[model samples]
Target: MSPRNDIQNIKVREERKRQIMNVALEIIAENGFANASVARIAQRAKISKGLMYNYFESKEDLIINIMLDGFNQLTLSFDTNKDGVLTEEELHYFIDSSFETLKNNIHFWRMYFMVLLQPQVYEIITPYLEKTLQPFYETAINYFIDKGYEDPIAEMRFFAAMMDGVGLHFILDPDNFPLDGVKKKMHRMFK
Candidate 1:
């Protein structure tokens, strides 16, 4: 058989990268970023340590990628229209899907929050987090402005704080967390 073409090569590369990332996320989530070394991640991923570097420059790069992946997943439903504006329907959808994502990916979010709680890890990820989340932050603020809130920034802050609180509460106590009730209340309040 002929060797893999460029398209095939790209596909293989992406798949391998994804496999490595998925494994890293789980290991970091389970082991915490401080302890989840690149060698450990590579071992968990069943890939050679040298091969892991071929995909990511270093352990920091690997975790940054994983963190961004979770952040992207969290914001996947935001501004669905791609118009750079959050509509009413989009707000409701974001509220709805945010809960859905939390419910569906608790372990990942748990790790995401765990990483945030680590001061050193948070410091390492802060710059990237700010850069990665700036667009969504602006869009969310714009959303409040369009809604004609008296203090758009404050409103946005309140909404964000509440949402984060809900997510954290659910993560801490998924079994007893009134997920549906909170979702409905959010929809009502934001409605």
Candidate 2:
């Protein structure tokens, strides 16, 4: 194939893969992972199961890819600069972006929590979680230390745990939860 055709083919393949993943995310989020069969995802995507298989090896593969993509995007939002260092302003940005993402993409958050609650899925994703989250963890700890915290590690842990709690409540009761109010409070505390 010509170079132009090759580029076109690559773009088409990427688009199709993204479509399959998006459908998979919706199906899995709405019906739980056990009910999100290849047939169901394919039906939702308006593609043949055979074609879906062409893009992903199995449902497990598809879910993993979706998670990896979602997490990478989340982390990227936290990282306003690609410098691997978290400034005070960047930390605030991360908190704001994280809340916004969680509020807007509740389906993805549900899918994540559902997967975490499943031992089978959790085991499969453990390595990916470590690899993807390690950097952010390190950055948080280092940022605390740089700010001259007496116990940087504990400070980091507390901050992270608090954020997780906020996320859980936000997911469970988004309509009633005062997300903006909580965000402003957190900003003041962290700042």
Candidate 3:
């Protein structure tokens, strides 16, 4: 096949895969993953279950892909322009962007939390989670270093842990969690 034809074929494949993922997310959101069967997803996607198998090896594969895609979307929302400097405004932008991404995808976050509750799914997802989150961790630490922090890695890790803990709390009880205060606290960090 010509290069142009190869490109077109790849695009078509990616579109189909994206469609499949959308349907999977919808089904998983409506019915928990344990109950969201491949058959149901195929029906929802208006495709054959066998066709889904062409793109994904199994249900677990589909779920992992969904989770990875979510993280990618979140990561992309951050500035990510590390030019050896990070202004307070840029830090605030990162924090707000991160919070907004999570808030916008509450259903996806719920699905992730549910999956984490399952030992089997948790085990399968652990490696992928680590791989996806490592870059964010590195970027955050680098941002701190650029801001003249002496021990950027240590500070970043501490802040990362705090963010994770607070995020989970907000996810569980948004009304009581005061997520709005996060932006203020983040501002204080820079000040």
Candidate 4:
């Protein structure tokens, strides 16, 4: 094939893969991941069942791709100061940005939380989750260390656990819960 033809073929393949992923996301959102089948996803994407195997190895691979994409988007949305230090304002911005993203993609977020609730699914995605979270953890620890805070690692881990717990609470009961009060509570922890 000519170079131009090769480029066109690559573009077509990418578009097809994206279509599959989008359909998978929709199917998994509508039905739980445990109920989402490759055949169902292919049917939803209007593609042959065999064709999905060309793009993804299996349903687990597809689900992981969706999660990895979500994490990448989350990391991109995070805004830190240019000096690699997070100010109080930047920390608040990060929390709000994270909450808004989770809210906007509630389907994916729900799927993620559901997966975590199951040990099998959690095992499948734990490596990916760890890889995705490592940077944030490292940054938080380093930020405290640079500030001359003692036991930076422990402090950062506590902060991370608190943040994760608060996020889960908000996700479960956003109507009755006031997530905006989290920053105040966190501030009080330091005082």
Highest-lDDT candidate: 1
Runs in model 1 deviating more than 4 A are: none
Q: TM-score of predicted model 3?
A: 0.73
In the range 69-166, model 3's lDDT, one tens digit per residue, is 86677567455575534456666777788788768876667655655556666677789999888877777788788878899999888877776676
User: 19-92, model 4: which lDDT tens digit per residue?
Assistant: 88878877766676788899999998998999899999999998788777767666654446546566656666
TM-score of each: 0.91, 0.85, 0.73, 0.74
Cα shift from native, residue 186, model 4 (Å): 3.8
Residue 100 lDDT in candidate 3: 82
Best-to-worst order by lDDT is: 1, 2, 3, 4
lDDT of 1: 0.87
Q: Going through the candidates in order, what is the number of backbone clashes in each?
A: 0, 0, 0, 0
Candidate structures ordered by TM-score, highest first: 1, 2, 4, 3
For candidate 1, write residues 62-131 as lDDT tens digits. 8778778878887899899878999989989998899999999898788778776777667778899899
Q: Residue 162: error of model 2 in Å?
A: 2.3
Off by over 4 Å in 3: 1-16, 22-36, 82-87, 148-150
Of candidate 4, the 10-residue stretch with the lowest lDDT total is: 76-85
